[model samples]
Target: MEERLIMDLVPGLEGIPAAESAISYIDGDEGILEYRGIPIETLAVKSNFIEVAYLLIFGELPDRDEYERFKSDVTYHTRLKLKILRMMEWLPENGHPMHYLQAVTSAMGMYYPARDTLDEEVRYWSAVRLIAKLPTIVAASHRLKHGDEPIKPRNDLSFAANFYYMLFEREPLPLVERILDTMLTLHADHTMNASTFSSRVVGSTLADPYTIVSSAIGTLSGPLHGGANEEVVRMLAEIGTKENVRPYIEARLERKEKIMGIGHRVYKTRDPRGEVLKGFIEELIAHKDIDSGVFELSKEVELVVAERLTGKNLHPNVDFYSGIVFNGMGIPTDLFTPIFAMGRVAGWLAHWMEQLKTNRIYRPTQKYIGKRKEPYIPMEERKRATAR
Candidate 1:
């Protein structure tokens, strides 16, 4: 038996190359990010989010013809099934949209059953339906909860713009639309994070794609995972100002409490996604002229926390700045995680497709500690005998 828990195995798992990928490298020490051998900074600055999605799914940047086809396919499938829209309406308004999304995603598998043949055309349609409808479902849920009528998707608009327009019932400002697009591109994929791993594990069993994605969403709903940004926003709100940040962080550090969004399981130094989001947050803040005092306070907290926990090697992750950007975009606090789902579903689908290509059942080994041999005893008889 192993004498101690091997925590370092977190990064280096045998036979699981999913965790480590040269395809998209995150250099945490230097705060650099790259996707498919291209620097993330360049993509964020130059490419639109839909283009990035195409890159992740197809493994190369699409040329004009391929890009047009991809966009057309996505746009054609953006409209939800009428039955699914009715189901969305039946969902409780106050309930978390992620829960609704999970249920809806799982339910989608039932609506679109996989054929025995499993032809390439079938798989292609499945991919299109998932990628296009996900944002529509999420945005519609947002509007539905707020007692507003869900806006129909505009085929002419880009995916990000359509999502924003649907949620707000008006055209988004050009800069805001671009920022949202960049954010979606940045989040389109990462190598097998917890939720992506969950999706892949399910897909390995040859389960329906919707079921796999639903499982992924359930995993991401946890606070330690996708929901951290919501908590980060609340934490910043509680801190209220730059002056309160140091004292608040000091108090939390004294208690050994985790400052939400300040740590990650994979990245040792800094999250590359965090760097991109920090820039977006700054842009949004300046564009909106919202004096939230969050950016200054967050910077102070990051500096002080790094100084305090030297050996822990913790830093602000992607979730740190994402909430601020969402808040700046006029998004409510509760809807943050659901918005994360909008971008993450693409990655989930990509992993699902990859898993299906090399079909295998995922069964992990567990370290069990129990009696090697045990005799069953009659509970009533043993208790009576003991009393006597």
Candidate 2:
């Protein structure tokens, strides 16, 4: 006789492979990640933001013609629709940037209603529009938070440079622009992260790209995901100085409180993204000269934590130095995670496109843990049934 198979249910799908994807790879034990088989560091040093984005969404490097077309398409669509602008203005000035991003992006599906998610032309244009407008929306949200007027997107500038322009209505230094570009590349994609999975799940239902992206942004707003960077910055401020690092870390460790930014759920060793950002932070500190104190404090804290966390496989994840790098670039901590969403929009859309190819609505099984069915009771016996 043939035997039936029994499957074990994993909560949160921990260690379960959800879907097959070729877009990105991660070896958490080895502390390695790659996009389309290209090392992130290689792209970080050599490629610009748009090129890396093209590579991620399309599955390979773009040639000159394709690259130019892709860049032009993104540049042309970079401006927010007047309706989107009005919506931004409608939001409370004090509301969270991520929340505005989520609401506006979801509403885009209503604005530009999609007739099809599986159409190549529709998919391509939707991806381009989301990637192009994300930075603009995020920058506008930041400006609104400060009661400042929104700056229009610039066609002449690169993606990162244009974001900075929209952010401050001023030109970024060449070095800063390049570093910010590199940061965008570093964040462009990761293998099945929270937001990526969220996007894929929504896309599986044949939802339009805008709704899929909005769903991903909502996932990103979670404290355990994208918000960790903002927490890192706040934690550093709470520590205040290098002198306070030791005691603060000791107390946290003794209390078993998490040392935010110091460890990761996936990586067993140091996160390569963290290492890359650390190098950028060091380079930025050298350039700033006068205000390297925060950099020093971060390093001091790392050293103290390193000694205590020796065998815990703990090391600085991407959040550790990314906050510092953004701070060095004159960006506030609150906007850090939203900026992350801007970068990650590429990855989310890529996964969305990929999911449509062999679409299957995500319907995972659950282990039921409720009382077995009881016999139906008459109305007269219902009160006595509850006492059981």
**Local distance difference test, each candidate:** 0.77, 0.87
Looking at model 2, report the run of 10 residues with the lowest lDDT sum: 281-290
Q: lDDT per residue, candidate 1, 224-289, as tens digits?
A: 667788888888888887888889988987897889888876677778777778776666557654
Q: Residue 147 of model 1: what lDDT?
A: 87
Q: Across residues 329-356, which tens digit of lDDT does each residue of candidate 2 receive?
A: 7887788888888889999988888888
TM-score, cand. 2? 0.93
Worst 10-residue lDDT window for candidate 1 reads: 6-15
For this target, which candidate reaches the highest TM-score against the unseen true structure? 2
